[model samples]
Target chain A: MANQPISEPAQKFGERVRARRHELGLSQEQLADKAGLHWTFVGQVERGRRNISLHNLLKLATGLEIDPAELVRGLRRPTG
Target chain B: MANQPISEPAQKFGERVRARRHELGLSQEQLADKAGLHWTFVGQVERGRRNISLHNLLKLATGLEIDPAELVRGLRRPTG
Candidate 1:
């Protein structure tokens, strides 16, 4: 799946991250610093290019100062 | 971090998964089939030995028949 287009869920997750980052007025670099992740990784995550791990998700939630559940709230498996 | 013990958050997440699985009276193999994941992987996840990605997390939540938020609800960053 390398180089394939991002999946819809990934895009949605990225949008949430971007929206939250914007709401907090934090640049990608700043968020990365707070999350102890690379800015490039943060950029990829915000662009739906990375399928982030739970640990990183927690880090991101911490960086954003939100409950970890907030990031994944309302997300569900697409019904057939 | 190779061979390190499971982190507290990972353990908590695993506990939630296991508890939910038990509540539904599903075996690891059954849950794995529902989640479209390998049974060994499901075992690892239940043991907190895997830091699973968001995609897989969704899969697990779907298999467990719960909102994604429920899996992560109440999780927070540990304080110093």
Candidate 2:
């Protein structure tokens, strides 16, 4: 068995979040405010530097006014 | 803004994880072993008692041989 980090999916997820936030015309600070999170934390999430928790995932989805599933759409299993 | 915990989605995700694990004929311990997680942690996830982190979510998805997006499918915004 090979062990590979799932960084690609995390990066892709971050990109989706960034794109959606842009589509909503929101600055990271504004999105963070809407999500009841700190701007730095949101930035870290956008950069895929941290693993987001489910609670925060819901917060992001609500802040973006999208389905939670939408954020993770099209993320296939990354090959190791 | 009304703040409601996203317990429903977490529960739904947990149910999906549990179902997938069962479909693969995996006990909690077995799944946990495959995912490199503790059995107690897997149990908590299956019970939706804790918010799952993205890293662990990926691990669970990989252990179940499914795409990560499938874990979050059909999770709508929980009403406040």
The residue-by-residue lDDT of candidate 2 on B1-80, one tens digit each, is: 12332388877888899999999999999999988889998888887776888778878887888877788865654456
How would you encode candidate 1's per-residue C-alpha lDDT over B1-80 as one tens digit per residue? 64442677777788899999999999999999999889998888888788888889999999999988888777764443
User: Which candidate leads the pack in DockQ?
Assistant: 1
Model-by-model lDDT, in order?
A: 0.83, 0.79
lDDT of 1 by residue, A1-80 (tens): 65442666677787899999999999999999998889998988888887788888998988888887888877765344
Interface RMSD, in order shown: 1.8, 2.7
Q: TM-score of the candidate numbered 2?
A: 0.80
lDDT of 2 by residue, A1-80 (tens): 12232377777778888999999999999999998889998887788766788878878888888877787765643445
Residue B61 lDDT, candidate 2, scale 0-100:
80
How many angstroms is residue B6 displaced in model 1 relative to the true structure, after the best TM-score fit? 2.0
Worst 10 residues of 1 chain A by lDDT: A1-10
Give the CAPRI rating of model 2.
acceptable
Which residue pairs clash in candidate 2?
none
Worst 10 residues of 1 chain B by lDDT: B1-10
Best-fitting candidate, scored by lDDT: 1
